[model samples]
Target: MSAVPILGVIEGFYGRPWTPAQRGRLFARMAAWGMNTFLYAPKDDRWHRQLWRDPYPEAEAEALRGLVEDACQHGLQFVYALAPGLDLDWADDGDRRALAEKFVHVQRLGVEHFSLLFDDIPYAVDRAAQAREQVSATHHVMDTLWPDGQAGLLLLCPTEYCGERAAPSVATSPYLKALGEGLRPGVEILWTGPQVVSTEISVQSVREVNEILRRPVMIWDNLHANDFTLHRVNLGPYAGRPLELRGLVAGLLSNPNNQLELNTPGLFSLTDYASGKSDWTPEASLDRALEVWLPAFNTSSIHRVSLDDLRLVSHLLYLPGGLGPQAVRVLDVARALVNPQTGAEEREALVRELRTVRHRVITVLRALEAGPNRDLLFDLHPYLVDVAEELQRLIVWASHRGEDDPEVFSYRGSLADRLMTLGWKT
Candidate 1:
């Protein structure tokens, strides 16, 4: 039940960054929960990525300075990552100097942890050359600033950050091999498992990368991330990682849901998962997290939501590869209800169960609208409403015994529907 060295949250999504207030609250919570890092690299922060060479404006600098101070006060390590990979010319010395200057400016504000991310960049045919340039560029900046090798928590997210994204494969990728040979001693690497949003991170996979990187890899876990599909949120437990994984890697940092309020269950469950639990089950872990999160759903209005309802909602949003227990049960009934071979008695049972699910979903939607925590309500509304609608569709199909009307959009003035059919996505 040992812990990974870098256990914390990462604010690195492709949308509006969390507010300073939200970040402050996160630092406090992480500090109390035995977590120790917070990576600040929101993609929409122009200064952090698109304008990586530019110094922060005085007002923004002051705000970041204060955030760094707050992180220090809470005993959490603050790491700032620059996504200059979008357009950095690694061969140019001036670009290297700009990188140094940006980090130095933040360093003056008492920031020590730093990372240079090369993910999501344009791929070059000669990936090894790209890897070599990135390694050299990072060294140039580090030599200018932390020549003594005291670069606190230095990290590099290679262009081929995961096995799936790796050119060819992890072991054979020239880019990864170049990084293994070239990264300066003590600089840690950030990997996002086999895929960018991995459903699992096996110990053997970590071992393979470790040998290739010539260092123990630190995971940038994105299991709970939902920025790509904003309509869906993952409010489930920290899972698919075994206790043995703690021994295989340098650290783990979760890049969770973009919506700050929706991440409580994930963040809290992750903390509990790492708190030396010998027998870790995602269900028990989430139940513990929901116990802490249920109060936020208790509106001042008499329409209160319960832990069971939250659990049901979590099932609906659940994991990437598999559904939660309750969700599985619901899907089972729906599937059975649709089967022609199902007995009449079994059909009655299935229909009864689905009606119960329909009732809970409707009641939860009503209670969510009466929320005392308006921000939480706002973040969850779309997903909850969508679930309710899907359940209603299932109920209608059941009532009709599977002979449903064809879905049709009249060609008269419904231009959007016609336009949608013009694309390959349809």
Candidate 2:
């Protein structure tokens, strides 16, 4: 296997697409981070998915041409993807021609790589027949465009792309077996491990799919995806998958959070994993990424809050587990405040620490509000504002011997409401 696997970022989330400027910035970042591919498959793009046969307007075509040029200049392969399975008549020759023609139009814009997506659509009654038709149609398109195999990369996302959606089982499913055997060897298939939003991707699982497909798979990782629920955001470092995965697959493309600015740390840590860094750990990688990420706020006050502290808060938001050391310490303070046996000195100490955390959160939030990363602030503003407000209430209660004032009761009610929104325990 090569030392560095083909690392890429797929803008394949179910939300608003990034603007042209955001994409230009993303290409430059991908180049600097040593990523080699960018898959443009935003699910909300009307023409790319719903109206797959329609031609792009003059202005949209110009924008796409410019994006292709930018990607090429950055040494990135811009893979143009179209999801036509929603209403495509795969057996019709006219439908096949339309699919080929749409791709050819993109090819004229200098995009050499292409993908045909059949994911998220309902399965046909005759599964095997559906699979065969999908394979045949894709083969026809590929043969028509690149008879000599000059098309840089032709990728496919089968309808049953993950383990849970695979009927009966992965090894015994007739639809998968047909796809594995019928599709041309030149074409690659995309997989999302055992589940759509997989918490862990093991080598054994990859090997199972690889044996069935007789080829290495390209991972479309949705670990950091937040489209399923708007209230959640994943900011934790990339973990769970072992480093041995570098040799098991063709490439790893992360489907990141909708908020563009918050994805820097996650993508940076993924780059470290792909680069084969022996010393890489998720905690350390997150800290290092934050060093570069926090400075973007252009605020001097942000220097006072440590990256570890920020990670502690973000970890609670994204990952599933008990609180970390910082949260544990804060909880301990809260407990002591409510304990009748606690002394004044202990209460004061706890109050001081809580006040400090509150101040740090305020400083960071203020900087974020005033900074250029408006997207990041928009995603996290509510959470930050709530934390600051809760901290103030906690401070006042701790100072006043857990007084049952209206403000404290109101804070308790608001805390419960916030926790419900995030699906977290109050």
* TM-score for each of the candidates: 0.91, 0.87
The digit string of per-residue lDDT tens for model 1 on 56-153 reads 99999999999999999999999988889888886787987888898899888888899888888888989999989889987876786688866588
Cα TM-score of candidate 2: 0.87
Off by over 4 Å in 2: 301-305, 320-352, 372-375, 390-426
Candidate 1 lDDT at 239 equals: 90
Expressed as tens digits, the lDDT of each residue in 62-171 for candidate 2 is 99999999999999999999999999997687888899899888888888999999999999997888899889978877986798875589889999899898888888
Q: Give each model's clash number.
A: 0, 0
Q: Which 10 consecutive residues of model 1 have the lowest summed lDDT?
A: 403-412
**Every candidate's lDDT:** 0.84, 0.80
Relative to the unseen true structure, what is the C-alpha lDDT of residue 322 in candidate 2, on a scale of 0 to 100? 37
Judged by lDDT against the true structure, how good is candidate 1? Answer: 0.84
